[model samples]
Target: MTDAADAEVRDGRDLYVEHCASCHGAELQGQPEWRSPDKGGLYLAPPHDESGHTWQHDDSMLTDYITRGGQAVVDDMNVSFTSGMPDFGMVLTDSEITAILDYIKSTWPDRIRATQAQRSQDAWVD
Candidate 1:
């Protein structure tokens, strides 16, 4: 990781606590029954851990989703899904967003991180 990312990851812990922990969980475990939809038919927030599919996404997708909000990103993709996640672009700086992602990536096991890194590379190649 770059020094800035290291610093962001370090600082992101507190930022996550303040902004993301309540819904995403203090341990990044996500909400209960996250795969199931609620009465309103919205799926609960998914985990950011190895058990979750967060690592399946490339960095640009992840960062864009965070910066633009899930709904907007989905809309841009012409996908027919609703996301309960709100936009953070108005609230967070680009560095802070990267920091939060770095923090989340920091939690993954090495193998998973490598896979995700490869996926990111593949995305760029495509």
Candidate 2:
């Protein structure tokens, strides 16, 4: 198999189908009532598109969210308890992860990308 750098993620639409469509919806619209919590007080999967707060994080953070899963890295069991997002470290090869990430980056508009880039840079300082 080729390396992550060698692999091409193509574009957001394709990536969304492979990596996110099952949970997030084919159009990145996420689940219905995604913002509202479930009966267990757990939040449903939220949208990754413009309507979502996904733009709040930078690329690295997003990567960590994928690799480590937000709950694991955040030191919060509650987050994990509520979050349906799974850890892909064992499931996805590094290159696949990178490609998925690239796909996510492709989805964002320039402004969001720039903002995310800056946040990722700031993370390096801490």
Count clashing residue pairs per candidate: 0, 0
lDDT of 1 at 45: 85
Tens digit of per-residue lDDT, candidate 2, span 66-121 = 88775675555343456667788876776666677666665778888787778878
In candidate 2, which residue ranges exceed 4 Å CA deviation? 1-7, 11-15, 76-81
State the local distance difference test value for candidate 1. Answer: 0.89
Error of 2 at 4 (Å): 11
- Residue 28 of model 2, lDDT score: 71
lDDT of 2: 0.71
TM-score of 2: 0.77
Residue 24, candidate 2: alpha-carbon lDDT: 80
- Residues 1-126, candidate 1, lDDT per residue (tens digit)? 888767778899888888888889999999999988789878788999999899999999998998889999989999877788888898988888878888999999999999999999999999
Clash list (residue pairs), candidate 1? none
Candidate of highest lDDT: 1
Stretch of 10 with least lDDT, candidate 1:
1-10
